[model samples]
Target: MASKIDPILEYDFCVAFLSNKWHTPPSNLKDFVVTSIQQTKSNATNMVSIISNFLKNKSFDPYVKDCLRTCFDLYSDSVSALDNAVVAFKNKDFDTASTKVSVSLDSPVACQGLFNDKKGENKSPLTKENRAYFQFSVIPFVFIQMCRIHN
Candidate 1:
């Protein structure tokens, strides 16, 4: 129930999102879903970034803020890795990129209670870099939906 957006309903929504964005004539629902799922996974981080941009670039909505808060804690470890990469890059240590990616994957930030006591600080469900991760989350669902349709 955490992700209140119902997968059942969102499958249809995803199809719509796809039809609007892709102009190619897919062979069938299977192809369309497969392509769209791949693209969504590939661009997931981009979508997260876009959503984060939407949050920070504009006033925060209460509903959006709540939703973001729920998910942001889950992303902390990933954010720290991004921070680490920046430090390594600024120090001209290119060799550590692999390590940085490793840390980000394993040491994600704890987003629980992140906004509990903070006041006057802008809360993002995702930071600029974290937004890029959103795409990663969307692709699998679409892929599964495609399978369902094909089957």
Candidate 2:
């Protein structure tokens, strides 16, 4: 029930993340890996939709507009990377899957970085979304790493 049976994925955040998302607990590493990939893909897809909505808002200033546009691009790429990762996972290519997942993880950080002004006064409107995406992205990378190690 703790969702920490795998020593490689014993982190508290990972366990809690999986526990919240999974209705039936994962029985083994493959279950964990498959679920993690699916969930991360779903998260990325949702993020794309959210960013698209933000882009449609016409009241945002030019600076915020620029940041949102870039963030939208990053999240879009993240979705593609996660999609490729799903195929790689199905092929049992842990290396390719991990690489793609790792690429997906960078999107959140890159998106967050777009808000850092020179004076450090700007804040990302997507802060919460970026945080969730980063966490969702990490779970699959960790599971894929475990798969690589065991295989």
Candidate 3:
């Protein structure tokens, strides 16, 4: 989906170069990649807001509540890590940026695991979307770091 792909399109070239799973991107690619990192930053900020709102308004069983709390913490941590990564990038500290981005990637896995551990099914819609958002959030930085390696 273009919506899914748009956030990380700028780094697509780096991904192709690193993975050996290369393919030529379509024309008008620049327009697609034209979305700046600021948009991802905004998305991450919005994630934090959404999670906080959900946590504040929702009530559930204690275990499920705990799980939600954990997810909230992870999302917050990811937002911080992503912000730090951006700062590192601006400072030309690519290694530090990469490390921060790598750390942020773990939030989704942990959050998803929290859901599965609670039950086989019936994951909350908010958590599902948040997990996907967390995954999407890290992708651009991944490409940016990879591009740094190549260049």
Candidate 4:
């Protein structure tokens, strides 16, 4: 179904958060959204700020900054190092996969392709490079964080 809100402003899982119901993973349309967030390993607290900023903090017009902070924080243990390891494992390139991540900016794909070009390994640098993660998490959370921000 076409959404009443623009894809830019409209959260990916707008219907689910709007309805305030359990997001039955893999079945609910919101599942895709939750899946995306889970896959990204976004920081819980920073992410909530972006979500709340959109849903509650209608001032300062905080947009992507909130999301970027969340993206960079790796307390969840799903950082680029882990990603490269997983990708290498899948491709059988454990040698490169085992390398510790220390990225800068413009090499997110490096999470899978280890070329010793430690760039884009972390979201913090990229966030400063380009305020995109804000849109990444904030927009999506608008549909998921219907409960409350933890921190």
Ranking by TM-score: 2, 3, 1, 4
lDDT of 4 at 18: 40
Ranked candidates, highest lDDT first: 2, 3, 1, 4
lDDT of 3 by residue, 12-91 (tens): 53343334332443244221121223345556667667767767765665656677788778777776777777677667
Top-lDDT candidate index: 2
Which digits, one per residue and each the tens of the lDDT, describe model 4 over residues 29-142? 345444434433343334334434444433422333454333334322334443553454346443343232222112233221321234544323233312333333333333
What is candidate 1's lDDT per residue for 59-105, written digit by digit as tens?
A: 66675566564454334444455455445534545445335544433
| Model 1 CA lDDT for position 103 | 43
47 in model 4: Cα distance from truth in Å? 14
Error of 2 at 21 (Å): 5.1
Task: Give the alpha carbon lDDT tens digit for every residue of 2-96 in model 2.
Answer: 22534333477675785585687789988877777778888888988998888898987788889988888887887788888888988999889
List ranges where model 1 is wrong by over 4 Å. Answer: 1-8, 47-122, 125-151
- Clashing residue pairs in candidate 4 (N, C-alpha, C atoms within 3 angstroms): 64-134, 103-121, 104-119, 104-120, 105-120
TM-score of 3: 0.64
Q: Candidate 3: what lDDT?
A: 0.58
lDDT of 2 at 57: 88
User: What does candidate 1 score on TM?
Assistant: 0.35
TM-score of every candidate relative to the true structure: 0.35, 0.85, 0.64, 0.26
Off by over 4 Å in 2: 1-12, 21-25
- Candidate 4: Cα lDDT at 30: 46
